[model samples]
Target: MITGASSGIGAAAARLFAAQGAAVVLMARREERLRALAAELTASGARALAVPGDVASEADAAHAVKVAVTEFGGLDCAFNNAGYATAGTPLHETDAAVYERTMDVNVRGVWNCMRHQIPAMVSRGGGSIVNTSSVAGTRATGASAAYVAAKHAVIGLTRAAAAEYGERGVRVNALVVGSTRTEMMEQVLRTAPELEDRFAADAIQKRMAAPVEVARAAAWLCGDGSSFVTGAAVPVDGGATAT
Candidate 1:
């Protein structure tokens, strides 16, 4: 199961997981885009389903997992990747509504997902789950204060889940995602084009990551290859956190 599966790293991870022979349930708010991606993957011989809903809603999150188990038999992994990005204007300057909206999607969304997903995974004996955070998760990053706070909260949720379920075969981890060539990034650049270079220069790679690059990292964490890694924040960033 992949939230935010309509685009960016979520979309890329959906393709990679299907290619690797896992049935995928695509979850996001955009029904058209999710269904279109599902059709393309299904036509290519992979079992894929689209579940459209807001991740912030507990009932919706539960229903997405239900679809995965009912349609595909079981869900062995999940990428809780639905989130949005915005500039950190100043604490006082940030609109309260915008801040609340950010927290709803980025923080509460993950809370809703894990509460439902863990029970399903426990039922099947074990599974892997990944949450999306960002460089802002660890530092100020010039993003809005709310975004930074919400992301940091995600890491707390990831670690807490991992600790609670590690003995039960469930692995929970967070991706410290960096600036990537995502639609969100493009939107940010529209107002501040220099941010493109600023983001790249913050990383050792000196370039923005393609969404697929981050997707690959997420896939690895959810796969058996990272069997021993849990309760940790994995940096999919290009060494930005390293600096």
Candidate 2:
């Protein structure tokens, strides 16, 4: 199952996982995109389903998982990648509603997804979960205080969930992503094109990552390849944290 599967890393992960023979369930706010991707995957011989809804809604989260179980037989993995943020203006200058909105989608959204995903995984012997975080999850960046705080909370939640579910055959992990070329980064770049080079410089590799690059890490954590891995903040950043 993949939330935010309509685009970016979430969409990339769904494609990669389906190509690897895993039945994928796509979830996001855009029903058209989700159904379109599902059709494309099905055409390629993958079992796919589209469930469109907001991750912030617990009912939506739960329903997505249920569809995966009913259609694909059982839930094996999930990527909680739905998130939002407009800019990184200083906290004092930020609107209160913006802060709450960021928290609702980034933090509570992950919480909502895991609450249902874990049980579904447990019922089927075990599974893996990959939640999206950021370099801001570990260090201060140019983003707003709310985005940083909410991302940090994702790591906290991942660790706690990993500890509680490891013995139960479930592995929970997070991605400490950095300067990726996605809609999120595009939102920042559209206003300051010159900042693209600056963002690239922040990464030791001197370039933004393709969403597929991060999707590969997420796929590894979800598959048996990383069975021993849990509670990890795997960095998909182009060595952004190295600095």
Candidate 3:
């Protein structure tokens, strides 16, 4: 199962996972796009189900998981990648609604997914969950303070869940993502075009990541190849965190 599967990194992950033979359940608010992607995958001979819903709502998250179990037989792994961010606003200038919405989609969304996903995973004896954090999760960045704090909370939730559920055979981890050429990043760059060079320079590779780059890392974490890895904030940041 994947949240935010309608576009960007989530959409890329959906395609990658489906191509690799996993029956994918996609959850995002964009019903048309979600169904289109599902149809595309199905046409390519892959199993895909589009469940259009917002991750911020507990009921929606629960329903997505239920669909995954019902259509695919059980939930084995999930990528809780839905997130909201607004940059360039200081905490004082940011409206309370912005802060609440940031926390709702980034932190609470992950919380809701894990709450429902873990049970199905436990029933099947094990599963993997990869939450999306950010470089802002570790330190101050150009993003708004609300975004920074919300991302940090994602990592905290990932670690806490990992520790609590490892014995139960569920592994939880997070990706410390760097500047990627996602739709969100593109929008940010469009607003402040000059930030493009600055964003690329932040990475040691001197370039932004493609969504598929991050999706590959997510796939690795979800597969048996990463069997012994858990509770890790693995970096897919093109060396941004290293600097």
Which candidate gets the maximum lDDT versus the true structure? 3
1-243: candidate 3 lDDT, tens digit per residue:
999999999999999999999999999999999999999999999999999999899999999999999988999999999988876686789999999999999999999999999999999999999999999999887888999999999999999999999999999999999998888888877777877888899899999999999999999999999999999999999899997
Off by over 4 Å in 3: none
TM-score of each: 0.98, 0.97, 0.98
Instruction: Work out candidate 2's RMSD over C-alphas.
Output: 1.0
Sort by TM-score, best first.
3, 1, 2
lDDT of each: 0.92, 0.92, 0.94
Candidate 3 global TM-score:
0.98
Instruction: For candidate 1, write residues 1-243 as lDDT tens digits.
Output: 999999988899999999999899999999999999999999999999999999989999999999988987888899999997787578998888988889999999999999989999999999999999999999988777999999999999999999999999999999999989988788878867867778999899998899999989888998889999999998988999997
Error of 1 at 81 (Å): 0.5
RMSD of each: 0.8, 1.0, 0.7
Candidate 1, overall lDDT?
0.92
- Candidate 1 residues lying further than 4 Å off, grouped into runs, are none
Candidate 3 weakest lDDT stretch, 10 residues = 83-92
